[model samples]
Target chain A: MSATIHRLDNRPQPSLEPMVQLVAQDMNLVNAVILDRMQSEIPLIPELAGHLIAGGGKRMRPMLTLASAKLLGYPGNRHHRLAAAVEFIHTATLLHDDVVDGSDLRRGKRTANLIWGNPASVLVGDFLFSRSFELMVEDGSLKVLKILSSASAIIAEGEVNQLTAARRLDIGEQRYLDIIGAKTAALFAAACRIAAVVAERPEAEEAALDAYGRNLGIAFQLVDDAIDYVSDADTMGKDAGDDFREGKMTLPVILAFARGSEEDRRFWQAAIHGHRTSDADFAQAVSLIRGARAVEDTLARARHYGQRAIDALGLFAGGKAKDAMIEAVEFAIGRAY
Target chain B: MSATIHRLDNRPQPSLEPMVQLVAQDMNLVNAVILDRMQSEIPLIPELAGHLIAGGGKRMRPMLTLASAKLLGYPGNRHHRLAAAVEFIHTATLLHDDVVDGSDLRRGKRTANLIWGNPASVLVGDFLFSRSFELMVEDGSLKVLKILSSASAIIAEGEVNQLTAARRLDIGEQRYLDIIGAKTAALFAAACRIAAVVAERPEAEEAALDAYGRNLGIAFQLVDDAIDYVSDADTMGKDAGDDFREGKMTLPVILAFARGSEEDRRFWQAAIHGHRTSDADFAQAVSLIRGARAVEDTLARARHYGQRAIDALGLFAGGKAKDAMIEAVEFAIGRAY
Candidate 1:
């Protein structure tokens, strides 16, 4: 276990480059499938989808698929198509999410919903989702299909759960975990699990990768939430306090509210319920969060999940694949700083 | 062929009752699957989904699946779950459609989007869609998966296609057929075709059922478009000119534009482009449509498809199932009058 442990502090900086480099050749195939399958006779389908697909996303989920496959020594191209399907599912969710959140900017650019309006965004998202299923069906693996379709349902359920929990100060850490678990981690888990499946590995191996992806996903989301309070638009790509502006409940806010004094709690209540919104309000909110050490604790939580994620890959043999996978977790956690 | 022919005029009124009765017992099982699968830990999922699912939809697509199964003399319970899956897909599309169209009323009730907001509608629609695939995956039929998944993609493509075509006075009849054939008829075809696959029927029979459902769906849409001009909300269960107000292009408008005099063409161009939208404008539009005989010609087109739908069933043996299926087509077209 000690031998498999790859410490992040041993290096000056942790990066996603290792995973991206490990899967570089495979990533090309996945990208091709994404570009090819996203095409439709309708000009807008390709034009709008291309805006995001061609947009500078890290392809994190699909990269996980390729790297996991490489780690297992899986010698097949099935994961390439499957990886594209994962990205499509992710893209579809992003499209709907932008509409749901009414987000104007994503990854430092205007959202598809912002450019095309919500109606086109919704329809095209539906298209990509259906296309993802079609890709799965073409792969013709019931096991893979079941995993993805179930993950998709869980993600949607989680989204609806989060939607219902919005602006409510009473939502606790456990409920928040449940929401992110379903919404963010489910796909991450499925993305890695399918690699095991396509590799025809044992159930134990599949479970290990699933654990790896899931914990990493939770860490990934936690760090994103934390970064919103700590960083601004240029560095983060997503604007800081965008979640606060949308009144999204995250770990930082929940912890701050729970740990705040009477006046601080009143400020949070106003902020969550929509009374507090401007840059000054966000600045104050950040100060309150810092005072409560909410962001620090949030980063601590991300470290917990990131460690679990790293530990999950321990059972696999030590190699470049494992190092990249472990470092990917680090990069996810490292993003907030 | 002569013995199988059942004309609409043979009865005082054609109704959806016979087909509904033919599939009544089977629909009960399908309904159970729908209710059971739509549930989640999140309360809003069920509450919001139930608002639309239990709303007064006629269950047309699933009923076609059941009746087509009966027509094939397939003795199996598999179609019930699959039928529910089909319904789930339809419901998901309706939820998204409401958001896309900003529709206020459906089946004489306020839309779920109107009640719950667009975000909830979008998320719940995605949930239902994923649940539909999960049900199909549980059934473990790759062929059915291919058909439904493909159809879902086509439906979404059609929707996007229609979005681009909206309010454009230049869109003609062929493109409209292509659009409806996708958005409406593809699901209808897949719904009927999957029953044959579950029944283990040959390709010819599957194609026959597909043809039957496709034509019926086209006829259904034509009649629906025509009724929007000829009937009121009390009878039609949807507000007349709602499409017109929204600047939707249907066969009626295309034909009206194609056949109208220059003066009339200018009115339609203005109406479609948003210069005309009021009770008075709709009344004037209705008069112009009547003067151009667009509604009459639209119903004529519906009957043409209805005849094709009936003829597609001619390959099957004449019996209660066939009669009900044929009558369903008649009921579809007869709604216009």
Candidate 2:
């Protein structure tokens, strides 16, 4: 029943042993601060938030916040507050995203929407968002507020783009990157950059941390798409091929569909456009994806980005924080089971 | 053909000597700032925002912001930015409110949902909300941000409360006031108080402006409920008795139902609780409301709040801004047809 207990027998062996140890150490401090800041609001908010926060999420956003601040040589404890703020914003968006996507499961647990009604989830999400802004204002840093606010706007716009792009097979790679960057990477980048801003890091170092976060987010999303059909429900926290069932056009599916024959095109049109897909349809789609090696291709792209994320962090001087960040990028792509 | 021109003509007329000039001058500056701040990276965002911003609703929130600042003897133009920020937040909420309420008409024009679809309106409203925070961050005042963010949180909570209370006629007057205060008055109060904060006024003056805005907002909502039952679509820009049709429990209906006879209670139970209301049910409800003089009694309460709003201004020294604010309170509760 423990969501964080992964079945490690089938997991990939990570090469960054030293980095993993450093991240494990930093994560202890980050987790404590997150728990403390999450408790500052009223009981109702934390009660609702606890359902998701304690549900075994990776806490990657907050980790980036804390790690980037440490890498930038932050002497103050405000980075912990900023880290908590980052996680709160990300968590709030997840709560709303589940409602909008009508998702039933998240992080291997029943989503907030499945437990509470959509209205409650939405209002609670709003509460978390406002509370995050209130926390940031308390820091009295206009630069941090501006960066976070703009990132929030970008995230909302990305969701809108995804809404319009759902089931649209014609959506191109550039548009997909834009959408994912806004929805996922913008927050990741903002979280890391804000930590650097708080630490008063050099401009080049701040930009490098931002780039690292962005690339890591993109690579993470790529792996998510690659695992859609291959990962089991127990591992992925949802039914296999749910995106295909919902007519969502992910990268692997798009690539597979593009390489399919005319008959295959008809099959996709029947499933995606007509919304008449069955288990047999899912089987056939999986077969076509395997035949085209779309999943393999997608994973390759994810690895490339993962490497780029690690390379970006080279701008900062090597340290435990930098090593942990590098390990995070690798884990995001495919190391995590 | 302009929505503003028609709506302004039907609004209650004051002496049109000093208040009119002041409102116009304040609104002109506020409107320009609003137009400037609404621009975004996404083209459709600014376009959708422009449609709503130029849609001709009364800029009451911004006016309060400006008046509060002027009364505090603000010598700089930062108040104009704050006033515009207030209006943007209000407009953004309205955009989302119409979608949440499933409304089809606003200011005698089609709702944003009717024009661009619910997704666009909802997302654009979010953009505006985020933009408002960005503008406030530019002002470099953490106190103002805290007040506005808290106001926004309360507003969202109020909306959720209203959604849960819908079609439930058992809601009492105090509960209704709490709901309306959260939904309407919180932002208004924050807007006024923030102006004083920006002006660096004394604490006593800031509290008074907050109280004044709060009372005025409550009075405005009370008058709005009265208009909903009595005014036609042509004048009110919405269907008459819309609240009743939606099974919302407002002040007059709550009071009337409480005083109704057994037979009258049965009628209400069937129409509201049973959800079997028709034109005949509406007519009967209207007649019962008239018979009980519930609308008149509600108007009396609104006028009381209007007077309280004027009294709150006693903390400030008398000036043109103070006079306009007092007159604005009177106009809020007075007839608008």
Give the Cα lDDT of each candidate: 0.93, 0.77
Reference-based TM-score of each model? 0.99, 0.88
Per-residue C-alpha lDDT of model 2 across residues B243-324, encoded as one tens digit per residue: 8887787888888888889888777777766465676777788898888888888888887777788788877767788777
RMSD of each: 1.2, 6.4
By DockQ, the best candidate is 1
What stretches of model 1 exceed 4 Å from their correct place?
A1-3, B1-4
Residues A193-231 of candidate 1 have per-residue lDDT tens digits of 999999999999999999999999999999999999999
- The most accurate candidate by TM-score is 1
Measured with C-alpha atoms, the lDDT of residue A105 in candidate 2 is 83
Q: Tell me the spans in candidate 2 whose CA falls farther than 4 Å from its real position.
A: A1-12, A15-48, A72-75, A266-276, A317-319, A335-337, B1-20
The lowest-lDDT stretch of 10 consecutive residues in candidate 1 chain A is A1-10
List, for all models, the DockQ compared with the true complex. Answer: 0.96, 0.45
